[model samples]
Target: MQQIKIKQYGNAQEAFAFEEQEKPVPIDSQLLIQVEGFGLNYADVMARNGLYKDAPKIPFVPGYEVVGKVIQCGKGTPPDFIGERVVAFTRFGGYAEQAVGDFRAARIIGDRISGGEACALATQYCTAYYMTDYISNLHEGETALIHACAGGVGTALSQLCRRKGVTVIGLCGSEEKVAFLEAMGVDFIINYKKNNYKKLIENRLGKRKIDYIFNTVAGNSFKEDMKLLNYGGKIYCFGGAARSGKKDHILNDLAFLLKTGFVSPLFMMMKSHGVIGVNMLRIADNHTAVIGKCLGELHQLWLQGEIKPVVGATFQASQIGEAHQLLESGKSMGKIYVYW
Candidate 1:
């Protein structure tokens, strides 16, 4: 079997290496999967760079979600699962021609859903569903401000919001991305680099404020984002990419604290405002069943044409480094798929 593995902790392109390995066999509780497609996630980037605290040790296969068919079943496994097409959230080892996991961990995708959509539901889309539905308590008709509106989670959120009739103000870094969001059915599009997004929303909404803010770009963006929140609005913080890769990242946090003063969470308490930090990986660890339920729900929506996966690009398993490069370049929109 051929697999992609992280050679060590460093640059992703340098760290990822393709190699041959012995085919894996399943135990009584596990199922052997013939790899079809796997979703590339930010976690995989972190795993390659050694930034993820929970990342597996070096010289390990690195993929988080996979969509494929069950080629072999373990002892005592159900006869029905044989040759069934499914998607599974494997903590590791999905970037290969074959992978293995427990049968119960896999979700069988119906014929209505394509392999690409099933792979998406296993990761990025699942994260967005859990973040909005459970962590943020987003409701229909509520206005949402989503950062990175053309990215994987952003696109998924837009689709989910469109289904629920939630008014979404999508924020992006470029004009091309703004156009992309407009095509995705977003209510408003702001290119943060060219215009002041905070001012644009303020001017249009007229102090209405965003009812919910789903943010993946924290750092300098957080301060401005918080200002756009209505008195009772909730901000779901997911990532600090905007503040990362800097020598004084901690200092930036201190500056934000000083600027906001005691009125951060204190204001949330006094005026019903809320800031909920969300890490989907953590949620998946403690609430696997909850996450699984969200995945199932999103999968059903995809089947019904209420939602869709935007696969911006697909690369072969041998081109794992190229996939990582595209992710780092920050140019691609939607989910990137790696197929064997």
Candidate 2:
């Protein structure tokens, strides 16, 4: 098997080292996955920087999702799953030509879904769907604020939100991404680079407050969104990209924390707006069943033509560094991946 290891944390080009290794054998309840590809997420970049506490030690494979076929099964694994292509929510070790994962973390996919498309269903779409379809209770004619709206999870949430007839205010950092959101038919698309998005949100909704807010970029993003949430409204934060960028990004996060401290628990209770944080790694580690269930639900949505996974670009496994750099640049408009 060929694997990419995070040799050390620094620049993306210098962070990962590719090497040939013995093909891993699955242990009890694990499946040997012949990976066709693995999804590259912003989280992968943060892990490379030693910023994500959940990440493994240095010199580790830092992928969370792989799209591939189960070529072998270990003890306690179901017998019928030996020959299916699936999307796997691996806790780690996904950046390889072949890898081992617990059977519970993978779900079967139809033959029609491409590897890149299947990759999105496992981590990105599941997080988006779980938040909007299951938790937010978003309704028809409601208003949603989707930050980083051209992102992987953001695109999935936009699709689901549109399907439910919710009006979406999409925020992106680039003109290109704003155009991408415009093509998705967001009610309003604002380029955060040129416009004051907090003020944009205020100007767009003079009186009506946001019914749901999806934030992955934290810091002032969450603070500002909190002020605009409607009574009984919900806010879901998954990542803090504001705190995870390259070059002095950690400094930026510390600055924000120093200035704002934390959102007052008392204020949250008094305002009657619910705030929730999601860490998919925790879900993958403890609630593996939920991981499988989310993938199954997303597969159904794909079958019904209700959702489509967007792959902005695909890279070869050899180009892992470039893939990470692209994700770090925040220039890609949708999910990015590297395949064998």
lDDT measured at residue 171 in model 2 versus the true structure, 0 to 100: 88
Evaluate model 2: give its TM-score. Answer: 0.95
| Tens-place lDDT digits, model 1, residues 1-340 | 8888899866656887788898899888577888887888876776676656577788888877888888998897777878988887777888888888656557788566656667778777887887777555566778988998898988988887777778989988877787788788888988888999888889999774788888886666777877888878888777655543433345765764454334455667886888877776676566666666877787778777888899888888777888888886778899898887
TM-score each candidate: 0.89, 0.95
Alpha-carbon deviation at 324 in model 1, angstroms: 1.1
lDDT of 2: 0.85
Question: What C-alpha lDDT do the candidate models reach, one value each?
Answer: 0.78, 0.85
Over 207-322, each residue of candidate 2 has an lDDT whose tens digit, in order, gives 43898989998777777788788887888989878776444466765785664347677877887878888988888788888888888888999999999889999999888888
Candidate 1 global TM-score: 0.89
